[model samples]
Target: MSEWTCAGPSTEPAYDPSDPQSGRALVNYHLRELGIGETHLVRAGEHGLRYCRTLVPEGIGVCRAYVLTEAAWPEGAELCVTVSWSPTAELCRNHTTGAIPTGAVEHWRQRIAATAQALRSVGFVVEPSHVRYSPVYHSDADLVVYRMPEGVPARRAPAAADWALTEPVPPNHQRRSWTYPERSPEDIVIQALRDAGLHAYHYEDPLPSGRVGARSITQTVWPPEADRCTWLTWWPHPTFVRDPGTGLLPDGAAQHWRDSLERIREVLTGAGLTLRTRARPWHPDTDEEVHYLAYRVPRG
Candidate 1:
């Protein structure tokens, strides 16, 4: 018989009133203070508390960022604060801040350093001296990160002043598909068509492979068929689309594809385009078929 090795209870309890997991506890605490009903704890790794609305506890004594819930933020809201640690450490500023401070070049450096230290204290063998920073603007798609902590090399923090206040893209890069009893396929197709540049409407089309019956799609573009085409198209392979009724695919690959699609949708929407979806259908025969279409609606 093989013996099992138990690391014993995590060095710390899953819950500690003093430290309480940084992200969720902070979010839950804030939501409670605001009397926001039905608020749920969203597990988003380290950055979770940053997405939540309520400010983190002021006197926690140490400085670090946490993920916040995305849906809670008001549009275009900017967070500002000065982070002080080593007293003499530069008073860091954050304007276009998420849960973490932003706009303070020195503060970012410090946080990254602190995180490196925290990781090491937890027994990660990382070299903070080699750390470096890089600032990313107009993108939060890669906001959350988790590594062995100890083995990471130093990287510079992106200058906070350089970061613009905008919604970071969701880390997972997949399309978020939701089905509602009231939302019709035609409605979705029309919305996507208008989002794109060319004028289009829902047109009849046969579905691909095992799907039954044709669903909805954008019909045509405007300019009387101009010699130039301003539209581009791509399709998700069978491996990507899963039956919502049935959750299939290996957990990791499925989640990756899902997040990828969501990222693509955000990029398209950011450019004023929409990707309307329809029910999978048959009669189109093979897996390679136009499952959906996006048309650009002429902007006035």
Candidate 2:
């Protein structure tokens, strides 16, 4: 039930990425991978492993633990782990953030040491890897298949199907829940969310820091994505997308975000807030023309 999530590969020989699936089954796969059995976990070992109660476990960690994915493949995505240092408390002491003061520099050093020890305990070696940190959070970790060491053999591969036999599969259900501010667009937006089979819960972005032009507001977000929402924020005006001045989206992640955004868009336009766009700023760094969508809100 924690906000942290770490994703490891599905690793199910039957899992096909082209048609990805997540839910309780993946959770079982991970528990077996970790060699632990706990209906719900507070923490694992002294360090942590990922786990979470889920409509499906797409490798989202529960509490503050990491999810175990496909053993460790050599030079594979799984082997490349990213360690992030929490930002300084002075900057992140706001309620919107759970900075918890990542604790002094030594604390992070201990974190690295402890993490390395835990991994080694479980047969993972600390090969060379990159390190980076931001003002806060990995709220995200992508996993890949890892290669096992030469001298030691890897643990027996566990199958989700086998694990499910021991653990009863819950009756299938969907959490198409929705809650939103009583206002324009949201009312219309709810319909799209329900249609998409996604949930909508209210979220409060940290109040704007005292930086120039910082804007924050209570908003609603869907499915695991924390922070700003594109729909409500673009209310008064602002549409966004790749450059070249066209309604086009490249495949993969970009298209996915746009598709989600468009869901709310079609509903709003249907409700009569016509979308309008005039200008798009050049990329702040790359100078490419990426633009946000703009729209004209209805007159009261």
Candidate 3:
């Protein structure tokens, strides 16, 4: 996924001062009346078409023209436009013939297909309308409508579903099934990064026996957001033991870093391990008491 820049509209307050929905209706009107091709006004859920300048103003947001076949259109000619709050709210005009660089469309189309396939393989429905190709960007190519399985919310849909069909299912049904993580608030977080987007996989790590461990939480922050900013991999725990007076380690420590002194002891105690509590900082200079349990899982 390409970086989702705040593109398509101006951030400045609208001079016309029209309500968002009304503004959308007005834009659709001009597209139809002006033969600007058919247009759609979309928001969170509701969407409609307006067909005159009176209906929608000319200056809207970035609009993309689609080659509408009788089949493509449910009613008449159809054009899909993207409206947003950004720097260029004025509707995007139709691109010139060959305006899209040669192979650009194909490139995005291929990416869409590949992403769709990957999503499907993970037990998702990869539908036709999901793959969109109208507005092309130098960095990103298309918009993909990712859908979830029968019971999941649209917001929590898995990515690139088609990939599931190719891989063989694991013998362990528990591991094979998709179990939304319990600890984390969201099952997945997709954010547009520089060249590619960051997809954070938040799920419980499955144990070898296919059973989720009590401490089964796992988070995979992909493509390390940037070079300078190191990603913080953290885990949380309820409580820990630490001496308040001296914030330094007592020495003879293996994995007994100051940060883990209290929390590790707590976890160990919780797991029925006999250990002594000591006062220490996670690092040499820090003095904050450590409560959230964390460890760096080795990555390949």
Candidate 4:
């Protein structure tokens, strides 16, 4: 597991607080490093402080550039310009890796250096240790095993609804899926979809062997605006079906995928949603089938 550090100067002579352009320049310099040309300025007088918010590169996170006034610090420094990058909510949702990427850290370091340089050019005294380094962890496990912080409360698992609420369904986003080792109860899946404001259904299809398979599939259809569909399939066993000769999933293991077309047909008749399905070849090794389901959702 990788650890993160957040650093800033302990003490420094502040820059001219009356001049907001200096703050803007500091933020622009950092933005330039990310190849972003857009200028964002939050006037100091209007907000009682100056700050800039911009998207980080490679969708790693977001950067906030702000000026710390002397009044806020213990030492009567004129001003301290700070640039910080924390993961964006969306990025955090999608990234399973609980650590900041090295590339992201390097980008942040370069931006911090640029912001500090901008401050120094304006007569503010800067020090090498100006940037403080404190560790940041994405989860409690990371902290307990890595940092071993004492007196931290035991982490509790977040409720499904709570977790779902944290990630808003993207607008016009047609698909999302979740697979479980065991078949997730239909009621539970339906309730979750409801809580997340998504409409979907569950269908079970037998494999090519014509035996009742141990897989449960959920197909979600977004609103007409999204014009997209997503399928989530769950296998009860780690290996759904095995290939006799190679100890891998046989090609015919996915023959049951054709049932998805029938599932879509039912949706068209029962739910009034139109969808088209096409069968592609299945991968031999993984026994993965590439089925293309396309449709334009009917507009209300």
Candidate 5:
């Protein structure tokens, strides 16, 4: 994914003292210039903020544009805009070149330039130096962080551990199933492991066909175990698959995964685990994105 940021001096507060509605008008004007139609006005606290987002379809790829007031900036310098694009799995799947989609960089460059110009037209002083473009990894991943309870020590080696985690292919049932199962496969796996009195984490292994499945699972058994913890990832393969005829996944698939993940996070935290790092890394095998939440486990 690529990200571009532009910031400049705010000519006027989002709220126009002379006419309260003028603030929305000004925001709409700039957003229209950027071809962003859907806007949400947030009037909370002391500031009036306008948020706009749009998807721009460019040569075999799609980018998202976001415009909003920089609330952290002082009243005089609060205007900012960002545009970003990370190719979706569908786009990558349909890509014919067998490489990263071409022309994405140039497309974003042009769009960034246009956005900066639009901000300038609105009386914000956007400078060339203020515009920046850079690569962003795992742009679609979610993150959760927490700290483990104090006074717990790392686990000690035993002749045989209670459970073993391995990166195994999605079972036949999961591979063929097209409907949302009664329970999340990952949650079921974790519960089974815990039921058997084991401490473990699991992730999906990247498949050779540029696809991924529920595969990676492991006991926290690595050596040199310290206060730090390994990263745990939940790749949403089942959620990404589209329904047979509709060309879309079930409604709320993404939200369902989010809620499941949050539940898992809560469970881990309740178990006295501390999160150290949350990251999204492109899968080494499939080149697809996955999110990882890392937590420190109290050793025995």
Candidate 6:
């Protein structure tokens, strides 16, 4: 590159690319590019295309980062890039088993796309690559990101980057019992959804005598925002609230609930999880309807 040589003697303590005054940004880039996993002497005038040979069109594993030149890259390899997640306490505790979902993946994807467009504006060819999640993703995972569009002043972009993990209201914060078998998919789903920046909780039905009973969580994942009904019947169903004057539900709150469900669906599908919604009547006296959404994994 204009900053430094693509083929050079691989050396330790590589130059920092951020220091523009160094005028040798590619020294470190060359070292990292050629030494992915291990070092191979990059011959001068090699054109830097050999590194892309490992990419498979039908790659079926966890994502890995590959560097490619900007000059009209291999057609099949330029998959749109997405970024990985920032670590959380619960995330690190689980060892990233199964898939971890985050809105941040798409969040940074747009940033990279914007940066690439900025490069094109200044007369440069910018090609991106693909990325995806896999089953049982490890903590230290690989990712592909785009370079900043050069020849621009220092400016920042606006984003919403907060993962506030509040305590699960004490009564519902109980562990699973040994009576049932392995960890359920719903358990994993809640974790993935939280990592994706959605607030999800588990609510347990209390005992008959209003006492805290052993944790037997049976699909207790109704989001309060969506299931706007606050009170429920003795049976584990909502008391159908309606105005005596009009058949419409009270306060027009279920509309807000529907909006929340739509937003949650977008986040789930983005993370490659299946979400299904259904409305069913749950009253002994009359037909009263309740809406619910469920996360489902393909039967395998």
Model 5 regions more than 4 Å off: 1-29, 34-71, 78-99, 127-132, 135-300
TM-score per candidate, chains pooled? 0.23, 0.24, 0.17, 0.24, 0.25, 0.22
Alpha-carbon lDDT of model 4: 0.34
Better of 1 and 6 by TM-score: 1
What do the candidate models score in CA lDDT, each in turn? 0.31, 0.31, 0.28, 0.34, 0.35, 0.32
Q: Using alpha carbons, what is the TM-score of model 2? A: 0.24
Q: Residue by residue across 1-300, what tens digits does model 6's lDDT show?
A: 222333434443333332322222332233233322212343223565433112211211122233222211112322212222223223332432433455434433443454445434533334332212221222332233333435532222212121111222211213323224434444444455566555324345332211111121212122212211011111211222454566655453354334444555575577555533322223323323322233343333
- Candidate 4 lDDT over 183-259, as tens digits, reads 23333333433343333232344332222111221111122232323332223222445656768664544544445
3 or 4, greater by lDDT? 4
Specify the poorest-scoring 10-residue window by lDDT in model 3: 221-230
Which parts of model 4 are misplaced by more than 4 Å? 1-224, 227-231, 234-240, 248-254, 264-270, 274-286, 289-299
RMSD for each of the candidates: 17.7, 20.2, 21.3, 23.4, 19.3, 21.2
Q: Compared with the true structure, what per-residue lDDT tens digits does model 1 show for residues 1-300?
A: 222332223233343222314433333233233332123232333543322222232322233324322211112212111112221113322224522244444444555455445543533232322112323321110112222223444333334332222122111122123245433333434345345422233223312211111232111111121111122333344444544566554335444444444554564466554444433322212222233233233353
Which candidate number maximizes lDDT?
5
* lDDT (tens digit, per residue) of candidate 2 on 103-209: 43444444444434444555444432222212232322122223343665544443323221221111111112233442333344445434544322433321111
Error of 2 at 48 (Å): 32
Please report, as a residue range, the 10-residue window in candidate 6 with the lowest summed lDDT: 227-236
**In TM-score terms, which candidate is top?**
5
Q: Count clashing residue pairs per candidate.
A: 49, 22, 35, 8, 12, 1
Name model 2 segments beyond 4 Å from true.
Answer: 1-102, 134-145, 149-300
lDDT of 5 by residue, 1-300 (tens): 223222321243354423424444445445544443222333233255433344433432333333322211112332223333334334332223334345544544554465556555645443332112321211221101011223433223233232222221222222332235533334443553354333233335322111222322211222122232333544444545456686556666555455545555565566555433212223223322344333333356
